[model samples]
Target chain A: MAHTIANKQKITARVRRIVGQLNGIERAIESEVSCSAVLQQVAAARGALGGLFEELLEDHLRQHVAGAHLSDADRQAGAEELLALIRRYAR
Target chain B: MAHTIANKQKITARVRRIVGQLNGIERAIESEVSCSAVLQQVAAARGALGGLFEELLEDHLRQHVAGAHLSDADRQAGAEELLALIRRYAR
Candidate 1:
């Protein structure tokens, strides 16, 4: 719906960039980059991936769980899901 | 620390149940709840305030711009501020 139109392109671009980053990480590992340098890239890629998840989660809440046809239970469930996600990824 | 002990008590109990659903929608429009049931509780309190701004922008992008120590232009400017907040709150 409206949300999809607003975010589809940006999300697609992010995913594409993340894929490239992952490939680059593989190359780094294969070439035996210094441990610290390789770890830095790994951390950066993780951040990008987390950004993707965050964007999608926000869109889902704004369009489906939180803003659309749903019961109070659904809202609570969505909130719980969000909490769980934050716990899992941010830790 | 540690994602604020895993999401700060479920986002403070969803902002205290959305402030009791905005004081029950201002007492259901000052006690004259008739216009389509007060517009369906004002569209369910605007979907629980868009699920508390989508769980605080997904815990600030899984803890500060996609997993911390950000670069890559702050992860694409935090994905263009989440596509301009899903195009201003899903239209």
Candidate 2:
């Protein structure tokens, strides 16, 4: 339904790396890494996650909701779908 | 490189739908849609965006970061990548 079929591998790889980063943070905490350095690492991870978000958002905007292919009814459904998702996301 | 290359079309579609949803919001505002109705629609759109984010995050986790293919060095780089993204997201 989404791009998951085509890009599952790539996405998984990024996430796994995030996992490692989390591990790295654990190690940093154990080693008593400086607050600034640790914070930097945390920030980096957050930024990376954002990148993933941006990529997906961009894709969604360009193809499904406003793409040339969709009919008016489909478009309304799309909006409804998003509204549904937002409810879950907020939870 | 993220999964954009492989799933650009699918991702784009989702984004386009989100745009439509935004348009709907504008229309509702112009019509003076009820507060509850407008708020619900707004919430829906927000939730939809979150769906896009979740999809990307899931992929990042499954394919790129934690996948079996990457080396430790690559994994670390992935975390660094996320960290970089987080900084931008916060800004």
Candidate 3:
């Protein structure tokens, strides 16, 4: 959808930060950082990625699957489409 | 982390909805939903999965990578852990 297409840059920026963090973690591992410390960073990166995921889902709901302007038939169709995606991703 | 462990139910609910959406999409395909309509649902599903990813990332960041109570050494270690996760996910 246009919303995602338009917001690609925004999403990329966030993704880049996560990437940077990842690189840092690799260095820490190489240097033999403490286990607890390393685990903490891992958790942070996980959260950041999750945030990005949530953003995409919300956009999908708003713009594609749950478009406010779609007719009932269109909406039903959209629901089915989203359902398929969920099945694919969940597995 | 404890936070993610705590919020598992909340996250699962959202996930279930997305799954339901996916099932619908499969049915649509079985019945030969139009390409345009199917495509729209596909976009929606993509967005939903992305959202789920984001949610996990956020939890990781807040409870693990960027924990408020960590020491500098511990925090550094956490960063490394998060970085590893990012690299893994990105690839």
Candidate 4:
């Protein structure tokens, strides 16, 4: 949480770019662009979103799961949280 | 491409929902929401994007690569195109 707060600007910028990509996809579809072109844009957006997820996942692991200061219970909870997230993301 | 044109409304709706999800993420960040909650939203958006990609990929495969009417050369070209797209998407 603190890590995210510290990196708020960076995260926000990434989110903004992803939003723009999604909008481009919507516009392409609305205008009946070539399927290949629209697929390319969708892939780009997915990749960008994956990048953001990886960044957040790394932060969460460092702060919550792998911190040297965390107790056993806290680490266990963090592991469960991460596992649940991975399952959802994989779906 | 024909497949996409036929399903334009469906694809557009998915894109619109994804855009809304991204906007929600941006707003959550602006409001200083919990990292876990933000992460959940991000994962949901990623999953949605993945679903769209899978849909497009399947359509491309069926229409371009796997059509029985296609010649060997055409299938080869489709395979190459799909390979390129998968590489990009995987990255």
- State the C-alpha lDDT per candidate: 0.65, 0.52, 0.55, 0.82
Best by lDDT: 4
In candidate 4, what are the lDDT values of residues B21-84, reduced to their tens digit? 9999988888888677788999889889988988988888897789889889878877887888
For each candidate, give the TM-score of chain B. Answer: 0.42, 0.78, 0.76, 0.84
Interface RMSD for candidate number 1?
11.4
Query: On residues B6-40, what C-alpha lDDT tens digit does candidate 3 reach at each position?
Result: 25446446545655554555555455554344445
What tens digits encode model 3's per-residue C-alpha lDDT throughout A1-91? 2223225446546545665665665565556554444445555655564565556556656766677787787667656656765565454
Write the residue-wise lDDT of candidate 1 on B27-66 in tens digits. Answer: 9889988989878887887778776776677665444334
| Highest DockQ against the true fold, candidate | 4
Model 2 over residues A1-91: C-alpha lDDT tens digits?
3222124346446545654654565565456554334445555654554555445444444554677988787666656655554454345
Which residue pairs does candidate 1 place in steric collision? none
RMSD of 4: 3.0
lDDT of 1 by residue, A54-89 (tens): 677766555444343445555456545655764465
lDDT of 4 at B89: 82
- For candidate 4, what is the DockQ-based docking class? acceptable
Sort every candidate by TM-score, greatest first.
4, 2, 3, 1
TM-score of 4: 0.81
lDDT at position B61, candidate 2:
51
Candidate 2 CAPRI classification by DockQ: incorrect
